[model samples]
Target: MAEPTLEQLREQIDGLDEQLQGLLNKRAELAQKVADVKIATDGDAVFYRPEREAQVLRQVKARNTGPLDAETIARLFREIMSACLALEQRLKVAFLGPEGTFTQQAALKHFGHAVETISLAAIDDVFREVASGAAHYGVVPVENSTEGVINHTLDSFMESPLKICGEVDLRIHHHLMLSEHTQLDKITRIYSHQQTLAQCRKWLDTNMPRVERIAVSSNAQAARRLKDEWNAAAIAGDIAADLYDLKILHRNIEDTPDNTTRFIIIGHEEVPPSGEDKSSLLVRMKNRPGALYHVLKPFKDAGVDLTRVESRPSRSGNWSYVFFIDFEGHRDDENVQAVLAALEREALDVRLLGSYPRAVL
Candidate 1:
């Protein structure tokens, strides 16, 4: 066969791209038909059904006989779903910040880059926005690998009517960021959120014990404030550094190298079990000894694995405490339902905070 000219090869590739675009448009038309069917049948208009998408992603990952990786395939499908979802509903998401926060990055990662993300002031505001239907979903940090738990997020669950639909675990890498004009040695203060300050405590004690610490509302906010000052450096994530156009003076500055924060996706709809599931519950027990023990006994007897248990101050009555429990199983499971039923009778107030699939990440 004759060797093809570079111009001819380029033309052929362009022609293939045109065909691909045409097929994509046709596929979208079919998806619209599917949407019309769903609407006419009084069904949901969300074209990117999470359960189905998850299954597709799992299957694609499993059947990987590929030059392309599973993550790459999933990314492409996510973009396709983003286009489909836009046709179905304008995907609205709320995250904590003044932008460039880890939560904002997580919201994008979970919902994909196409979602319309809004930054709220507090984590509670994110929950409220989703609870009141102002946003389709809210993303907030639930726990950190090094910091144990985010009590505000857990405490907010007690009051909010929102349910956990999904989760995304982002590996957090804290960095010391400052403007280019900032002096290297004259660093008088280091700014970060209280949680960030706490997470990097050991590092601070060992490295810069004399640097005055100023706690801000969030890492992004700290980075935002750092833009104006020359002697101050912000301890924030790489995303914040990029957003504020700051230079990273130090990278992965947290005490732990394996730092990660798990974010929960809060919404109204219940998620079906993905076989691997986690359930959260809040139980208000009588202000007496063995009250909590009584509540947890059933799970212990049933051989159900308890992942987390925390006691938050009860707002209901005097001297009472609410126990937040996380266990391994779905609400739909018989054994899990039986345990919950048993707990309901023993506890004063019981709230099921939705069973969701354990995150693949």
Candidate 2:
């Protein structure tokens, strides 16, 4: 048998494209039907189901066999689901920003670009917006692989009644950018968020040691400042660089190549189990010698895997401590419930922040 000619292959590709388009439209029509059914059943319905979306993405990734990688395939389907959900109701997402920040990128990644994103000045404002019903959900950075934790984010959760509905892990790439008016030889000062500066500390020390480094409210804010300054450069990411029309002086200048930041989705609703899930809890243990041991004992006994455990100073007392814990299994799971019940009897207070699907993409 002869191998197919180039013309024959092209014809086949075109036919497949047409079929894919037809199927996509049919999927969209079915999504509309689902929305109608939801509205008919409940006047107030949440179109975006985090657990359901997570499960879909997971299945997409699992079943993928390919010319395309799992992540690429999942991302394509994510946009499709996002568009479908928009037909039902567009979600309002709040993120810490002046716009063009990594938090905004994470929100778009988790919720898809179809959402109406509002950029707030601070993390607390993101929480307040979600709590006040101004936004349906909020995205805020919880921790960075390079940097230990985002203290402000943890503190905000202390007082808010919001729950973690979903999460996204974004690989951070800091770029040293400048405006068209700036001269590389005359650069005297640099601007970036404190975390960005810290992430690129080694690079900055070796290359621009003499340059003055100033920490700003956010990397996006730093990029904005460069628009009018001729002697200043900003350390930011691609989004900010593009937003401010800045030229990249250097790319991926972060000291750590695999630097990643984890952002959490905050909302009022409690997400149901998605098979593979994680739960977060804020626990205040009585100040005692074996406080830490007692707090961890329940999980150990219940055979739950603890992913993370971080301590923060409690506002309730000068010497009191509050622990933020992340563990495998949903709160609704039998093992998790037993663990929580055990903790309640011993701990001063235990607040289940949420049990959400783990990052699938």
Candidate 3:
């Protein structure tokens, strides 16, 4: 086959570009109409419909017949949804720490660039931001592949009344970064967030055993501080690298390659099921041997699958722990509701953190 000339390729691209533009405009028109109908008939316009989004992605995946894979197509449509949502309403989001952090990156990835994000100093700040209506939604790390559950987030849930609207699981990649003027061999100290240090424990032990490890509030902040001095490195992701004007000394420096972090989106809305659903709850049981068993009996009898169960010290009473439980199913489901009703009779307190559809990406 004869190879196409550069001019011919450019012409073909031009034609396809025009067609894509037309299709996008048509889609936007339809979206506006949909928004109008929702407002006139339902009395409110829902910019994000998780169920509709899931169906759209699933259909696209089923109908894919090109070089683009399902994941690629889905991400494209996710941006499209974000654009349409912005046309209707731009959502404000809160995430942990300063910019360039993984949690902020995950928030931007899932919510798209249209969202206005506010970086918070603490996990509790994220919860409070959403609870006080300061931000439409908040993102916080729930669990990580290596470090396990973030107990601070779980404990904050016990104090806040915000609901889990969705979730985003992001693959974490930590990098060893340094200023342009720094020499790797002469490095005498490393700076990073405590979790980042913990994540790259093996790398640090093998490569820089004698070097000092300093813990900062976040990896991004540590990277920012690296610019002021030499003989020091910071462990952070690509965002930090670019923001701090540092070079990547080593990539994927974490102990494990399968590192992942699960983040929960907290909001006031109860997101409808997108075919899959997960609900969060806080349960307090009496300080007795069989008290915990009694609380879980209803779920066992009802055949409810518990996804996660974490215990945090209850400040209300001595020796009591608040159990933060995540399970599969909406709180409104008959079985789930029954289990909760039964649990309420035996438990000190039970709070439903809203039942929402599981996030696709």
The TM-scores of all predictions, comma-separated, are: 0.88, 0.96, 0.93
Model-by-model lDDT, in order? 0.84, 0.93, 0.86
Question: Quick one: RMSD of model 1?
Answer: 3.0
Q: How does candidate 3 score on lDDT?
A: 0.86
Of 1 and 2, the candidate ahead on lDDT is 2
Tens digits of per-residue lDDT for model 1 on 95-198? 98879899998887777778899999988899989888899998999888887888999889877888888778898988988987688799999999998998
**The 10-residue segment with the lowest total lDDT in model 3:** 43-52
Off by over 4 Å in 2: 1-9
Cα shift from native, residue 41, model 3 (Å): 4.1
Which sequence of candidate numbers ranks them by TM-score, best first? 2, 3, 1
Clashes of 1: 0
Residue-level lDDT of model 3, residues 219-330, one tens digit each, is 9999988888788899999988987788997899899999999999898877776667888889999898987788779989999999888888998999998888899998
